[model samples]
Target chain A: MTRDIWKHLILVIGAIIVLAPFYMMLSYSFKSPGEIDRGTGGFFGRQEMMVDERCVQLRDPNRDEIAAAAPQYPGKSDREIRDAIMEEAAVACAMRPVVFNYTKAFIEAPLLRYLLNGVIVTVSIFVIQVLVALPAAYALAKLKFWGREAVFGLVLFCLLIPVHAIALPLYIILAKVGLTNTYAALVVPWTISVFGIFLMRQFFMTVPDDLIDAARMDGMTEFAIVWRVMLPTAVPALLAFAIFSIVAHWNDYFWPRIVVTGSRDLFTPPLGLREFKGDADGSFFGPMMATATIIVTPLIVAFLVAQRRFIEGITLTGMK
Target chain B: MAVIDAPVAARTSREVNRQARTAWGLTTPALALMFLILLVPVVVAGVLSFTNYSLGNSSFDWVGFKNYDRLLSRSTYEKMFIATFTYVVVVVPVSVALGLGAALLVNSLGRIGDVYKTIYFLPVMATLLAMAIVWEFMLHPTIGVINQTLELSCGTFLEAIRFFGNGCADGFPLWLGDRDYAIWVLCFIGVWQGFGFNMVLYLAGLTGVHRELYHAAEMDGVKSAWERFRLVTWPALGPTTVFVVTISCIRAFQVFDTVEAFWPQGGGPNKSTYVMMFAIFEKGVQQNLIGIGSAITMLFLVFVMFLTLIQRWLVERKVHY
Candidate 1:
């Protein structure tokens, strides 16, 4: 009985630690400045407090200093307001509230556009990667050609080179080709991935040779065999890579940062979030957390929906 | 007779060449694309490292190792090297340990393990940039919830602590802004994001360990758990450990998004947190020194390749499969 109680206690503690920031982000997002001062509403402050009208205008002053100065609202003196704001900030930082800041953030930020770009890029990358990788995977898995292992080995070798190392070179090429500030800049350079090709090849190896032999016996073209047989059989592995690739590219900030210049249309969610921080009052804890909460939700939802397949993908792909 | 014979020979040679050209056609696109995207840049970086090519001006004058010379002369560059090494050494082992422990604990559940897995993997999917934004708020010293919580907990525990007083004045560590603790904070966030992935890998590795080995150990009366692990499971997990460690080290070296998001200027608080890639990024994207950035990137690429080769050699004896 004591062991069981202890086990439950430990689990509860672990869960609290895991959920605390999220809870704080949520609670603070709803809270007014006053409640955040009390540090009680967590992210969502008191229900009675009204949304500051300035948040909806989209023409608010730079938010970093002003938002940090926010605890003075509702008849508080400037000195007291500053102190209160600081104290409230300290408390919010501790609690990690989710509400008031996020509400303000939603009204003020360009979250929707950023999210749209992320979805487009992620989906397009996955679709194209599948099309290219599937054919290459089939050829590597079933073809009895000279230099096959050598080519496969070379593909694996390229995996060691970190993407950052290639970033500068790719940037130069894109600049020369005049693709910067365009969607082509974002999509073209990364169309061929060494890691994806290597992964697909590994997955294709697990398919029985007889399956391909049978398809060939039917006089199907190589492409038809790849489409009809290998592609369908590799669904689970593909799904796994898909989840990894989608989440990775969707959340990616660095590559997009390099590829994109001044065009706001091309800004992905991560970049948009950065712009929000720079533009918004940094201390509007409620809206900031709220924005963060909004930003994080789709990914969390995707993970939950595809949890089983995603887990298999991560585990298996890491295998030699 | 000689001209007729030459025509016959040439026709046969052209037909033979056509078969060779078909083989080349099948292979060209993949190889050409790879070369264009991957190889060309590498070669350019190698060449450009010897020149001084600044952005805003595309003048590429051969400077003959001046960039390398300048870097070697700088104390800051030396510190960056040391700091990056320390980060890799500290983060890789610690993350792997935490990952192994978490995986073991999560795996004890017979079914419905997906619940725990999803919860653990949540941080992995959260945008590091967005998370950094939230964390910046959370780590705020004044009026931040973290400091408030610290005051509440520590004030209750220690007599010296007072609420909103001088000694406990915003108990939150400066995190990324503080020189002493910034690297640790970066490492902590890194471990949190990475542990789930490692745990999943470890779990997979654990499952692949043959059941017969454990049964045989039990039959031989090897009662001690540590001995069983040392004699059987540890040996069984060798390949997984190697794979995990190699990938983890490579990932650690390439860590840019979080550090850049958090610090913006290559590990803030006096550049104490700056790693190799962060420095490369600052030069390329921020400073627009394409040549220097390319040089730095090539240097890092060579370093990673060398380290990977060394790791492969080191683990070759231990890896069973």
Candidate 2:
């Protein structure tokens, strides 16, 4: 009993240290700038209505605007009317810090567009990788053909080359073909996932040959068998692979950083967050943390919802 | 009967031929892409390492071995190698040890371990760049939570310690800014981000260890947990340890997100954290020094491949038991 208590104590301390930053990130995202700097707001931070300084400045009433509001405040002096309009603007712009941070996160940058780009890139890459790798993996695992050993050997050799290590040469290739700053640059190099092919091949080997033979007996062509027979049975493997691929490409900053330069339209979530950080001064921490939270939430939510599957998928790479 | 048998034999052979052709058809796209995307870049990097090749230049001079020599001789490159190796050496062993410790501790608890496991693994699931930025905030010198918390410990019994005493008198050390602490800070973050992953792997490996072995060890009078670990648990986790160490080493070598996030303009306060990947990005893409960059790339590949090969060799020879 004593030993168990000691273990729990130590583990709890470790958990606090591990979770501190996440706590800080979430807390900061909900606090106003004043609260964040003073570090005074506890957890969800006094959700007091706060005015956006930038919003107030942008809505500073010009002479014409004040004159236009003269009828509303009849018999009031010009200065008094101007002050009333300014006060109204402040009231209209007033919102909770959480709302401010999240709204600013979306409005200050094209975060939605960046996220869309993230989805497009990761989805396209996964779809294409499945298309390219499934057929090849099926052939390598099940089909008997000449040069099969050599092709499998090539796949194994390609496994060693981490795409990040070879980014320069890849960038050069993309540049030569005038493909940089385009979607193709982001998606092309990753289209051939040697790891995916290798993993699926290992999996395909476990599948019963009788099933495939039965498909062939039903007059299914080899192509039809790959899609119709092998794919359905490879669901668990493919789900694991999907999680692996989606998480990697979604969080990937290096490749996109290398390829998509000067194109905000093509920025992924990480790049967008990075750009936000680059120009952010002290007061922008709320919005910046909000951006970070938004970018990180999707995967974390997915993992929390499906903890077992996510763990299995992430550790799939390590098992080899 | 002989004529019928001949035609049947021919038709079966034709079927075999058709199967072979279809296999080729199935594999062609992947094979072509593997060559183009994976193999060709390696060849390109190797060839370009020997030339003064920039991206847009029409032609380049063949500066044979000059790029490699510069990498060997340059002070900056020396620092690059030093920083990269320091990170890998410090991070891999520490993270692996911590991971093993955490795994053992968690595995002992029946069901309560799941909570700790989930908490630890949160860092692994979070986006690293986002997490790195969060770390940057936490490490802020004056206003950050870390220093603020440290400051709160002043004039207490905790300040009786020498380091804490000094920090109490003077301000706490700037975690990211001080030259002496930058690389170590990076190492700390690397370990923090990575050990959970290793922990999960070790936990999985622990599950695979036979339960009866512990009963047998008890019968053999192995009373201590350490003795039990040595006898049964350690040997059972051999393959997992090899895998954890290799993966940790590779990841440690590729420590860029935190470094880049901390010091985007340069490596760190005195290039103290200028890792190889950053050097590659800096010189190769940023500066257009393709030759040197390619040389560094080749060197980086050699280190990784050698490490993986060593891992493979160890797994084959030692862990098969």
lDDT of 1 by residue, A1-320 (tens): 67445544654565566666667666666676666666765333446635444433333324465566555376665556656555554444342233345545655767778788888888888887777666766666666555667777877677676666688878877887878888777776566677777787788888888888798689776668777888889887787888878877888787888888697888888887777766665356566667777888997887688777767765655755
- Judging by TM-score against the true structure, name the best candidate: 2
Which candidate ranks first by DockQ, i.e. highest?
Answer: 2
Candidate 1 has an lDDT of 0.72
- Docking quality tier of candidate 1? acceptable
Candidate 2's TM-score reads 0.98
Question: What is the per-residue lDDT of model 1 for residues B89-139, given as tens digits with 9 covering 90 to 100?
Answer: 888998788777666666665464556667777777788787776666666
DockQ of each: 0.35, 0.83
lDDT of 2 by residue, B20-57 (tens): 99999999999999989988999999999999898878
TM-score of each: 0.85, 0.98
User: Candidate 2's interface RMSD, please?
Assistant: 0.8
What's every prediction's RMSD, in angstroms? 8.3, 1.5
